[model samples]
Target: MVKSKSIYSCVECGGRVLKWQGQCPHCHLWNTLVEAVAEKNSTRFNYTNEISRVQNIEKIKIGEEPRYSTGIAELDRVLGGGLVDGGVILLGGDPGIGKSTLLLQALCYSSCDRAVLYVSGEESASQIALRAKRLSLATKKVHLLTEIQLDRIQEVLGKEKPNVAVIDSIQTIYSESLQSAPGSVAQVRECAAQLTRIAKASGICIILVGHVTKEGTLAGPRVLEHMVDTVLYFEGDAQSSFRLIRAIKNRFGAVNELGVFAMTEKGLREVSNPSALFLSHHEEKVPGSCVMVTQEGTRPLLVEVQALVDKSQALNPRRLSVGLENNRLAMLLAVLHRHVGIACFDQDVFVNAVGGVRITEPGADLAVLLAIVSSLKNKPLPIKIITFGEIGLAGEVRPVQRGQERLKEAAKLGFVQAIIPKANKPKHSVFGIEIILVDRLEDAVTAIF
Candidate 1:
């Protein structure tokens, strides 16, 4: 019988320890030291001895080139075209955020003639089948397997030799060889490394689904994301139906590309022009609301900025912002007070980037600050005006990236006036709309108000 050796491991960073303590000195996580047993292995492979018997380095040769498209436009866009041959891609998102649904929908549309394996460790075959039925996908060549054992998954891949394989989640799959439990840092790291090797060796495109942490980062150690060839993050409001898939790391394609999708009663549907969905239809112009053009990755997006300012209730006024950073809003408010003398310290300020889109770019600085100004003054911005420019601490509107794209998106959305940074040169005059270039925030206020 093999004796079990006890070893302490940190739960947070997966660092091995000799003994347990009240606090983990490595990851700073309390009560994370747990003793795990591993079967003693007396025999080990001697790779150095084998290398001594081997010959010299041989000539390098090129390998096979084969890739397939999932037929989803938004997914393809984020992937920089399609899945690469022998690529390991990881897709991570919040629970119940339609990550599984989106993957199943994509697989359903793909490979009617080629064999594609869909493995799920969390759900049963019946559950996936019901979702497939709802998606109305004819899965002729698509195969579904519900298992968690790493050996079984490897066996299926070796036997079936599918063109593409998707693991519903990597956290749930565990190897009996590893003493650590599923979803643990050790298991997650080891399992991902094995899958990457398998995909590269067999020339298979494997897409692994991952769960996200509360901090909106991919769950598991940071190393799991680094192990894969491409890392795609599914982002959007849980309350809203719209979903955005963004590529954070892509070895084969563009890194910052994004794909937009909408959840329907049937399944996830791709939105070609996300600008239209974000724009609200209002017959009359509302006070404290204005339109702005912003860029997400390479694509330009047109969104609305709304602000509401009211009397303060307590000693400290409420500063609420949704889809926009709260600290940035407070900073902008301070800038308005100090430079422009807007006197917003005593009032309750609420600012939001409409359509559930989060705007972090300095390009939206002018739009958001102006919306607050418009709200405090009870003034309505011109119906035709749309603004895009970064606002400085000294009340200057700075230039934004891709000026032409922002102008084109605004013009396509029927905005007739634009107050942009004077530093940015437009490629050509846009037809119909009046472009008002401003150097300072005060100039923008004068042009709009």
Candidate 2:
């Protein structure tokens, strides 16, 4: 009989310690160590009897992996052309963020031709059925399994041999071998490792839904993300109907890919043209409003940048930003004071990207600065004008990647003029837009004002 012993494991790093401590010694994080049970003599294989073979790198043959479409074009785009055989995808999001709804819709649509299974450890069969019926999805061929035991789930997967399977939230699944509670660090890590091994060995595409921490990162040990083939995050506001899925890691496709969807009474509906969703239309051009183009993976997106400047009565003025980095905003304000002769030291400044969509790329730097200046001066930028470029500390306008693609997208959306870095100016002018090339911050201000 194997003996069980108590061990302390760090939730952030998955490092084990013999005793408990306030801070995890491995990761140096406070209060992340949790108690778990481990069984002695758990190893089933003898390393002394195992033999390994090595082959030449040139002798290995490569072939294209088969992909199964989820029947949603936007999701297909984010997954890098659909789900690959034996690939494991990890999807994380906030509660009620439509993670399960999107997957359910996809499985229903995909059930037309492929064998798909939805294993629910979180929801009951009737709960899932009610959601499907509410969404008016065709679920005749879709298979449902309500189980949480790791061994039983693996047994069902082997017996059913479905091409695709979804474990609706890995946090709820537990293994009898490990005497840890479900959703614990040890349980999550062990269950994910076993499921990934099964997917690879059986050529099954598995999707694991993960819970996010209060900080919006995936919960559980960090190794859980490393074990998966792809990592996707669902982002949006609860008040808003729009949701965005972003790919942070992918082995078969590109990372940072984005898929846009809208939540309706029925279910999640893919937004064919996501650019329109991020742009706000007004009766007239307003001060502190500017349009900019940003590149998300392979697609170019147009988003509006808005700013407001007000007199501050407080000793220290407040600097706030939404949908854009706050630290970058402060740096940009300093640049404006040092280079552009505009100061916001005594004013309260706020900046926001028009939609809930977060902008990470520095391509929106130029547009953000321009919007701030416009707001301070109480002047409106010209209508149908777009701008995008990176700004350096020395006030130089740096070129961004895919400049031509951004310009073309802006033009296609009826933008009449573009203020871009001199290096980003196209070799041949776009048919409908006039390009204003600026080499420095002063040049941009002069051209715009």
Candidate 3:
């Protein structure tokens, strides 16, 4: 018989210790270590006499993997042409961020006619049924189970080997073999490893809904992220109906891909034209409003970067921004002051990406700096102008990647002119829009005003 021993493990880093301590010695996080039982070393599978030894990579058979489409084009794009058979996908989001609703809708409209099982530990069967009815998805061939026992779930999976399984949350599932409770670091890691093994062995695609910490990350061991095939995050403001699904990691596809969606009473609707959604309409040209093209994966998105520079009332002027980084804003401000000779020391500056769309790429640097200058100078930029390029600390305009694609996208949206880095100037213009090349930030600002 195998014996069991007790040990404390850190939830933040998975570091284990012999005795209890207030703070983790490795991760230094306070109160994150939880006591868990460690079963004695025992091998579950023996393959000494079997033919399943290490094989040559060249000799291994390669077959085309099947893809299960969720019936959402945007999601399919993010997942790199739908879900692969036996893939483990980890979806994380804040409470009420529409994770469950999206998965339910996916199950309802799956293009693949395979059987699907959705296991939820947080909601009862009746509650799930009500939600399905509300979404008008009562007739979809999706099964529901509200069990949290990991052992029982595995047993059911063995009995009913569905092609796809959706675990509403991995944190709530616990193994009876473990003395620790659900959501503990030890249990969460072990459960995920076991489920992933099952997925590979049975060719069962599993999507695990994961709860996030207060810092907006998965609420279990950090290793949970490394164990999954893909990691997706749902991001959007609560006040706004617009939600963005972004892929941070993918074993089958490109990373940093984005899927735009709109939250509705019926369910989440995919936004076909995300550029139109992020750009606000105006009757006349206004100061501090500038259009910039950013690349989210292979897609080119045009969004308005708005800025407001006002006389300061306090000693230390207020610097506020939405959908933009504060440190980057400060750095841009410093560049404008030191290189461009634009004095904003006493002025309060506020910058935002229109429509609550976050812009992380530095390609928006030129547009943002121009927006601040336009607002400070009280001059509006030409309505037909589109600007994009990275800005260096030395006030030089830096060329961004996919310059031609960005220009074509802007021109497709009816822009007549573009201000880009000198390095990005086309040998021969592909679009009808006139290209304005600038090597330094001062040159672009001069051309604009």
Candidate 4:
């Protein structure tokens, strides 16, 4: 039998080292190494100890995996219809960001055909019940357990056999087999793996809540993400009442799916019109404002892109961005200077995606570029205009996917005009929207100005 040993792990990158050092040799993150006790391997894999037989491809049978509805349409959309049996989901967010409320509300309102267990290592039964009361949630089918020990939770799982189990957080749960404290790398990994095993062995679906670090990542080893079937992160500003649940990874559904919620006095209310919520309110469309339609998973969302260009008085012009990338902004400025006649070489540039929503797709490139130009020239584009396309280094406007869907969304939102790449011209003409196909950045500037 292998003996237990102590090992050092880098908290930043989850790299392991046999000995401690001032800095991690792999990730170069300083003062992030912590020691943890590693348990001996109780199960070994080798050719000499083979047990289960492998079946041939022709003899194997396939069937659709079963799923249960959480009774929330927005949640079901993000989850790809419903939660699958024997699947594990990890949800992480900032403190007081409504992670617990969302999960509890789902459990409380879900169709109670099966037993539901909520094992909380962070909050007690009373605390959860009080919050549920405040949220106006009531349920008798849900069972609550306040525990952190892995063995006790496993015992409950075997006895109750709930169709779905929710662990409040994986960081606070620990296994007795390891000497490491809860929230450590070893403990988090072990707890997650054991929970996953229990979920798969039985038909119970497991949802694990995770605490996020100051760096905005899950507070555990990176391997914890890989061991789960789905990973979701909550995004919203602390000052704002809006919340967005985004799926980073999903095995059974489409990834990058988004669910929008509004925090009210009672609880979270699903937003029926996400585009209106994510748009900046203004009586008139301003010079620095532009509209763009970007696809989030299977849904096409319209968002406002804003930009400000001012003459710099400081040594280095400030290049700041929110809900967008800084490096991409710099590249777009360079492209505008090189291709379009507009120049912002010595100006401080700031770009933002309004309403705390992030636009990652390249289709928003044209809208951002147009907004910057509009700000620089002190001119506003048409109020009923929407634009989306990819910008190349050579100043050519590139086509984006699902062009018709984008145009249709814009039209539905009352947009009448659109600027898109020439290559993305639709096969059939849209009824309400007038599409202006542009081949070069210079042509777009000319059309807008």
The lDDT per prediction is 0.83, 0.92, 0.89, 0.88
What is the C-alpha lDDT profile of model 4 across 1-449, one tens digit per residue?
A: 86658889987677889899999998998888889876566652123224668899898898888788887788888888789999999999999999988888888877367678889999888999898888888767889999999999999998999888889989999888878899999889878988887787787899999999898998888889999999999878999999999999999899999999999988888998899976877897689899999999888899999999999999889999898888888898999999876778789999999889988888888999999999998999998899999999999999998888888888998989999999999999888899999999999999989
- Model 2, 1-449: lDDT tens per residue? 96668899888788889999999999899998888886454852223223668989899898887787999999999999999989999999999999999999999999998899999999999999999999999999999999999989988998999989999999999988877799988889989998998888889999999999999999999999999999999998999999999999999999999999999999999998899998998998899999999999999999999999999999999999999999999999999899988999999999999888899999999999999999999999999999999999999999999999998999999999999999997987898999999999989988888
Give TM-scores for every candidate, taking all chains together and pairing residue i with residue i: 0.89, 0.96, 0.93, 0.93
In Å, residue 95's CA in model 2 sits off its true spot by 0.8
lDDT of 2 at 145: 97
Q: What lDDT is reached at residue 162 by model 2?
A: 93
Check candidate 4 and list the clashing pairs: none
Winner on lDDT between 1 and 4 is 4
TM-score of 2: 0.96
- Pairs with steric clashes in candidate 3: none
| lDDT tens digits, residue span 304-329, model 1 | 89999998988999999988888888
Identify the candidate with maximal lDDT. Answer: 2
Counting clashing residue pairs in each candidate, in order, gives 0, 0, 0, 0
- Evaluated against the true structure, the overall lDDT of model 4 is 0.88
Quote the lDDT for 240 in model 2.
95
lDDT of candidate 1?
0.83
Per-residue CA lDDT of candidate 3, range 19-113, in tens?
99999999898998878886555553323233667889999999876786888899999998899988999999999999999998888777248
Candidate 4 worst ten-residue window by lDDT: 43-52
Q: Which lDDT value does model 3 have at 330?
A: 93
Give lDDT for model 2.
0.92
